[model samples]
Target: MFSLSSSADAQVEPFKGERIDPDVTSGHLNHLTPDQQAAFNVFKDTLAKAQLYSPERPHPTHDEPTLLRFLRARRFDPQKAYKQFADAEAWRKKHNVDALYATFPVDEFERARRFYPRWTGRRDKNGLPVYVYRIASLSGPLQKELNTIPPERRYQRIVALYETMTRFVLRLCTHLPHRTEPTPISSVTTIIDLDQVSLPTLWQLRSHLQEASALATANYPETLSTIAVVNSPSFFPTVWSWIKPWFDEGTRRKVHVLGKDPGPTLRTLIDPKDLPKPYGGELDWKFEDEPALDDAAKAVISEMPKGPVVFENGEVRRPTPPDPADVSSGES
Candidate 1:
């Protein structure tokens, strides 16, 4: 393969694995400095006082961890964080988000999953879940299929996928029995392939894309570990200008814009076996094919603890961490 020019190299920003100052990325429950600890205690108290949260929440993705996510997204300012927290709780109830995943039709869920980034069923070098999006493939049937769905259903697809990632994938990966990594795998590592995304396809996806971006930024808050944008065309800068405003600064910092060639940079963060073939790895998977399960995912089914998670919307989730050790490494 021929080498790319220095001009091309200039666009290739590498992934930095940044943590928000005061180190909130090291999971939400612990490792906060004394000052941070006090702020969290106050944050919890504020939620309790408002009665938005009755018992505060648990580690990983529940009330406790969610408080930390909101706090960090708001730059540790308790007041702004409180408003966001209040709004999110209200939004969840209004949308029935807690049970949206459980009751979302299996047929619809399977169909919708194809529209967004498909999880690789593997983890990155740091053991965070890995996802690959073949955006160039979003034309013809993919575009037509997506457009045909009712507007309400399309929006529900977004919420359902987010809920699945937060409640299901994060829970399993965080608790895998043999994982030696001390940090709970609360976030994800993403590879966004924009090799040949046409102008028409981009135009078509703009609304759904922007809405999903806004939703994640508002409610999910700080869940992205790293996003490596690969195989981008020369026009990417213009496209990015339109899309960049959707994410907050913290989220933007996690994006690595790798122009045209992505192999070298990708190898630095993801191993060959774990990464998919399209991204220059040996996994032997494709965008439309069934996802291949890695050992860790298989272990989730066979080795991890299980629990009955009954949502307020009357739907139940599986394996809701019996204890901290079950989901976290007990390091923090």
Candidate 2:
């Protein structure tokens, strides 16, 4: 590995994690007082000694602001944080996260985006990547493709996609300009638009939502700073009630339920200039834009490869015929 010169190191700014001050206004440990930092160190050291520790595993340094993200999520309770850290480490191994990251499934992500429409777009006011999931707009051939997967396999694939995509987004955060260590960048601000969601749609998603909540809370741990559920319908309270128990106190508190006009809440958390047009923000960025989905995703639904075919202008078009040579060679 190449080493940074002393001159290069000197230019590196001291992040909140490197300071003992409680007055730091930004970054991962911004909320941590000097006393809290001291207490957290004990927990961090304990976690490092746990059986799940792997020397080769990629993680932020012990003193890095990112490490404190998990600790802070557990309210600086070392034992609880250790369980989260250890479990996450084990889950990564079991899921072969390293391999997944190295070889990202571009086509699969393209397919998944059609169904989920969740994407990491521009940074929020705090510089956290904005995660938007248009829950009400689950259409296209990808929906059929996702449904075709057996429940058990679907669960695994969904979990893998969730974790993998999260890591990918966080990785992208590292490259954003004007970023400081830890604090906001370590967490994401999410908007789950529930407009047009029917009862049947809610029922179909119940299991996947449950598994996703459990996986995120247990494994990802404190990765979400905010979850603004906008455009919530009358039935949303019932749906929220069913899923509310899945979240921990910290997570539940982060969730903000809003009605059709979520502009005010979104404006308070995000700069109006950074907000999407639908949410009363000025950002020209649209969910269907490829940039919003990042490099891992393909073009918008219409331009994507046709598997089961998609509804175009309110009509379902016939699927394109498979390539004869590809079929003969048994290629996907």
Candidate 3:
């Protein structure tokens, strides 16, 4: 019963329902780059197809409440997401992308000397850098002195130097591991017990001390002292493991005079001349008196609390009765 004009009118009404300006409809895309715009166009096409074909709720009909809520629920806060992506990219550029040192090798010293001689300048006759020449030039005597320093010691020194320089380089180059950041120990405490440290930790401590000593010798030669502390006999094995490779036979024997038998008691050894003058009054090898273990035992027993008497069958009991015959004999 419907006329063809009525059907055409209904189609025209839907088609011409409303017309928004393209600029107004696509205002959000104004801030996006060309690449982002291309991506958004594809996304729009996909969204349109999804709305046309899918049974799920179609794209939001309104901008303010419905569209904003949908975008928010989907975590589509474009500004925040962009900012986080930018920060991650910057961090990767700064630190994570850089080349890292593969390993600290003893031979690196010679390589460094060859490649960057100016950084490792040769000393002159009076042990000063040859400032006039750019390249390091070692005198015959200085080269001989370096060569004579026994292979093992040379390696240790070289490895120690390489570690120091590498640390300097890492601090200089990287932003990660946050160099200026403070740790709990830095704020609250300074001194640490060496006894609680592991072998690698002890090695690091030793290397640090060696670096300090070297720096002191370079800058404040007069105050430099060749002193070391051996806190316990147990640490000797680890110390010798690192030190023995660097020393000649004579130096090794002199340094490790303990030989096959480490002394029974804990002993401190120091170069006599290096000792403070007050303590150098006399060589006291003899003990004035032996330790009285009986007195020490008595002191310990006197401080002990009286405990309850216990019977053999695991029952608590009163003090056992003394012999009545012995008591009568004592009275007689």
Candidate 4:
């Protein structure tokens, strides 16, 4: 159990609450003590022996940070980490992650966004990107459209969306500049707003939630640093009880559920100025084509590869990413 300090009260928190030194990249075992580093090597060797080969391409090389993520996720157990690593690699191969990344459905993504806005816009206090989701707003016509789809097709689409979103995040993090040196951003702070959630909506979306949770823990590993579920309705506890078993201890500990007012809790991790207005912040912004964001926020937004945006009313459009070479040169 790591000691995490809540910035709000400066109180010692439970779980793996150790501060990730801003200089440290996610999973960089070099920061570990000699014994831990040695153990990580053995984990890698053991992982190589596992049948985690990919037909799509060569298996990704296990870097220190990446290996360390798996090790830490499984509590530094080399055997367990190797199994988890292999399972994730296998899942990637089965899902064809490369193809999904290359051919993302911009239109479908926009529709989904309109139905349920998901985006990473502003940086939290720690300089890490914040991925926000408003599930309560995911009702109405968008839900109807989803309902029309066949079960298998719906499952496939959800998987694709998850993969695309994950890919987009990976790209954004890849381009993000280090805060100082050797600390490339690798994780995101998540906010799931549940202000107006209903039982019907929750029940309908249960599978999606479960799949997403499983994917995050089993596949994505330690990509989520902090999670805040704001505006939880009265039924949230009952819902959480049913879903709690799905989340690993690490993931569960990171999640903080807010009853109604999320301002105080959010302020602990983010500045009011940086947060969007819908969630009790000063910034006025919408998940639309043109957002009411300030200059600093706009500057950060410019770094992202622009994609299609769908309004609340049914409409479709697309925007293209800048040239990869151009993006690369700009980042450099």
Work out candidate 3's RMSD over C-alphas. 36.8
TM-score of each: 0.81, 0.71, 0.17, 0.73
lDDT of 4 by residue, 216-328 (tens): 67776776677666677777666776676776665666666554666766776767886777676776654443223334534544433334321111222232343557334
Query: Candidate 1 lDDT, tens digit per residue, 192-256?
Result: 88877876677788887877777787777767777777777767666666776666556666667
* The 10-residue segment with the lowest total lDDT in model 1: 1-10
Q: Give the runs in model 2 whose Cα sits over 4 Å from its true position.
A: 1-27, 51-66, 139-142, 163-166, 178-184, 293-332
Q: What ranking emerges by TM-score with the best candidate at the front?
A: 1, 4, 2, 3
Q: List the residue pairs that clash in candidate 2.
A: 27-183, 28-182, 28-183
Residue-level lDDT for 290 in candidate 1 = 56
Candidate 3's C-alpha runs over 4 A off are 1-198, 209-229, 256-332
Pick by lDDT: which candidate is best?
1
> lDDT tens string, model 3, 1-332?
00001111122111221211111112122244565455444434444453411223453321122122222222454443333333433432332211112222325434323211111111111111111111112223444455465655454443333323222211111111222222100000000112233555445335433443343222211110011111223554555455444432322221211222212111122222212222221222111111111222234322211122212122223233334463344310
Q: Point out where model 4 deviates above 4 Å.
A: 1-30, 49-64, 114-117, 161-167, 174-181, 287-303, 306-332
lDDT of 4 at 318: 30
Best by TM-score: 1
Q: After superposition, how far is residue 37 of candidate 1 from its true place, in Å?
A: 1.4
**Candidate 4 least-lDDT 10 residues:** 1-10
Clashing pairs in 4: 4-17, 27-65, 28-65
